[model samples]
Target: MKKLCLGLPKGSLQEATIDMMKKAGYTVIVNSRSYYPTIDDDEISVRLIRPQDMSRYIEKGIIDAGLTGADWVKEAESDVRVVVSLIYAKQQLTKVKWVLAVPETSAIHTVNDLQGKKIATELVNVTRRYLAERGIVADIEFSHGATEAKAPDLVDAIVELTETGNSLRANKLRIVETIMESSTLLIANHNAWEDEWKRTKIENLAMLFEGAIIAREKVGLKMNVPNGALDQVLKKLPALRKPTISSLSEGAGYAIETVLDETIARKITPELKRAGAEGIIEYPLNKVIL
Candidate 1:
């Protein structure tokens, strides 16, 4: 079978994507100045491309599959199948929003206020469509970069992407409205999706990536509890489905294991201990299939 050509996004999302792939049981190595990354998998070849260009290239069949933001796919109007929506951004594992913003002191308080105003943004097409949807006609300029700084003086308002909105607030800007929410997506070319061999491989990769993402927010917990208190201890603990329980040798105790949200471990641990659970173990997880 021919090797699968995959394009990895090369900007801010690059490191995080690579790390996730590593956790998903793939070895990815990219040099500081190199666009071609080497992967340990023999069935796949990797190339680094900007997120903004990934959708169009995949649609054109330049590559079999790639990872890029949902917004880019929409902006490019590419005809590709989204294998999965990976909800993450540069430094955050949450949805990011593209918003219309202006100076805090500006009189523009709503999307309608920008009827004839000037807006700067890197997403020219998305911005144009957004304004047209609202029946507002405004001059949209393509910002090379630093779109947030172009407002007030360079433009009347700006459409910028923000994960936490901290950057906008720091620049003394307030969001007038959210234009769209985007998440990372695994996309496949139409031809690739139709090929049986390629479809299986792409689906396998998507499953692994999704498993790795699930593992990031969860942890495995194991502990032993007296038979008398087993029921009580189990009642206080939470699991993805149900906790795994097993008999200890010679009926010494019950060994219990389960997967749970990492955030609740601190509180749950103490509660379990008080309920006669012992030898508690908490560990990080690389992947969870379920």
Candidate 2:
């Protein structure tokens, strides 16, 4: 079988993507100046490309599959099958938004207010289409970089992508409206999806990616409880599914284990301890395949 060529997104999403792949059981390593990353899987080869170029590359069959933001795929108008949506960005695991923002002191309070105003953004095509949809015409310029800083002085308004509004606020800008919400997507090329072996391989990788994402927000909890107090302990525990229960050696007690949200660990740990649970252990998880 031929090795599958996979395009990994470079730049801001690079580190997070690599970390996710590692948790999914793939060893990915990249040197400072290398565009090609090394992966442990012999069946796969990795190339680092920009997220904005991923969809077009995959659509042209330059790579079998890739990870990129949904907004870029839409902007490129690339025809690729979306395997799954991974809701994560550079800093947070949440949906990112493309928004129309203006200087805080500007009088443009609404989308319609920018009729003849100048707008700058990296997403020129997407912004053009958005404006055309609303029957609004404006001078939309393609900003090379620093889109947020172009507003007020460089342009009357700006369309920028943001995971959180903190950056815009830091630049003394306020969002007029959110143009679209996007998430990271795993996409497959058309021809590659038609091949049985390739399809199966992509699906397996998608499963692992999703499993790793789920694992990041959760943790494993294990504890020993007196057999008589098992019911009480179980009642106080929260799990993704049902908790795993086992009989301890010599029938001394019951061992219980479960996967739960990491955020509530602090609140639940003390409660379990007070309810006759012993040797309670909370540990981080790399992946959890359902």
Q: Report the lDDT tens digits of candidate 2 across residue range 1-290.
A: 58889999999999999999999999999988999999999999999999999999999999999999999999999999999999778999899999999999999999899899899999999999999999999999999998888878889999999987999999999999999999999999999999998899999999999999999999999999998888898889988999999999999899999999998877899999999999999999999898
Q: How many pairs in model 1 have backbone atoms within 3 A of each other, for residues 3 or more apart or on separate chains, i.e. clashes?
A: 0
| Per-model TM values vs. the true structure | 0.99, 0.98
Task: Note the residue pairs that clash in candidate 1.
Answer: none
Task: List model 1 lDDT by residue over 59-91, tens digit each.
Answer: 999999999999999989999999999876888
The candidate that achieves the highest TM-score relative to the unseen native structure: 1
Question: Residue 117: error of model 1 in Å?
Answer: 0.5
Give the runs in model 1 whose Cα sits over 4 Å from its true position: none
